[model samples]
Target: MAKAIRQIKQVDPAPEEWQAASLSAVVKAAAENGESLIKLLEIIKQLDGMGVLNAMEGLLQNRVDVAEIALGQLNQPTMYHVVKNGMNVFKFLGAIDPEQLQTILSGITSGFEKAAQSGGQESLWKLGKSMRSPEVKRSLAMMTGILAGMGEAMEQNHSLPEGGTDIG
Candidate 1:
């Protein structure tokens, strides 16, 4: 069955109604988050006293041009790469469990500390001896497996993987 169509009409706010609504909103906001709002206003007052607020106001007055200039700057290759890598990092981090990531990161830090304590760099003979340790053997196997998986994923995606680049 087809539903009957009803014509919609727009209603403009009358001055009294708008005033009442605005005042009600202020009251509701104060009631809901009065402490936080007061703290924010106090921070603003401090900024105003320090002349920072007026500087911000002046910048905002020319917001359109400022935004245009910012957009133009962001259009540059370095800025583009910065934004792209930031987004990629966020995406990569999003896929991992926080606890698991912390564990792996701590393990890496521990490995570095242990390596530094032994010597700056091991001799080829020492490296050969170290490689025979079960722990070292296991780590190498795990690292190679992870690299293989990443290489396969890169091949499937057919896109060159990003290397960390800093322009900031």
Candidate 2:
């Protein structure tokens, strides 16, 4: 029988050999991805021409300082409210029906155009007569519904102080 193995010997490549291997692998990759490498080079050239590369390099070099400044700005009371309100607005929008919102926006745009054509010259009599129209009545009903919804939401969200009346 052969003698049992006592240890293992590992061979390590010299630094020059390692460099050559890495270069060969990179050359093979370049050959395989010639088109992508060309596009990447073009993008790099455009960014350099626009000074974006230099700006990015500077930003990276002072990342800690830039982060500190950003954090400091974000920690301000106004920024806190801005971020909070922005998130709330996003949530509110997310809850809306996009098609319904689009219809409403288009209606508002058309109303503005009509108003411009009228040049705000409509008499009180005409305005009063318009209230009898189905469109006006529908708009009024929508407004009333909105007000009712807002009242309900406000009552749910805000508590009255001790002995405070709802008359206000």
Candidate 3:
């Protein structure tokens, strides 16, 4: 029994070692450039824009399901934390009002219904493929530029003096 226990102990990692290994694995996984990562980011951005968190009480609950799907493709903990943090930021910024939240929920429900009626994942993938058009690209670029300008303005406002005196 002692010999068996020793063998088990030899195979099991120490807590600190395990943590380090996990962090290393996450870094390695995140280093990879893959379509799945792009898809994940796109999904997160869409969810943020659509105010998915405001529609759901426990926004992080679906994170486990997302992590499970991403297990082989991504570092589970990193993916989970990224999604959770993104959702938290969205919530913190007050991105969703009641009307917008309801619209997002309705859109999701309608999308699911349409997917069920047509096909399933294949149909959804086709829809996603269709959305990658030039018009969509232009719109995305414009929105990104607008948001970046807003962020820059906010930062400048916060950094400037109250009397707006020129430091130079």
Local accuracy of candidate 2 as per-residue lDDT tens digits, 1-168 = 899999999989999999999999999999999999999999999999999999999999999999999999999999999989999999999999999899778878988999999999999999999999998898799888987887678678775455544455
Candidate lDDT (C-alpha), each? 0.88, 0.91, 0.72
Q: Candidate 1 residues 46-163, lDDT tens each?
A: 9999999899999999999999999999899999899999999999999999998998798799999998898777789998999999989878998989877887787688754465
Candidate 3: 10-residue stretch with minimal lDDT: 1-10
Candidate 2 achieves a global lDDT of 0.91
Q: Total backbone clashes of model 2?
A: 0
- Candidate 1 ranges with C-alpha deviation above 4 Å: 1-42, 49-51, 119-121, 158-168
Task: Report the number of the highest-TM-score candidate.
Answer: 2
Candidate 3, clashing residue pairs? Answer: none
- Stretches of model 2 off by over 4 angstroms after superposition: 159-168
| lDDT winner | 2
Worst 10 residues of 2 by lDDT: 159-168
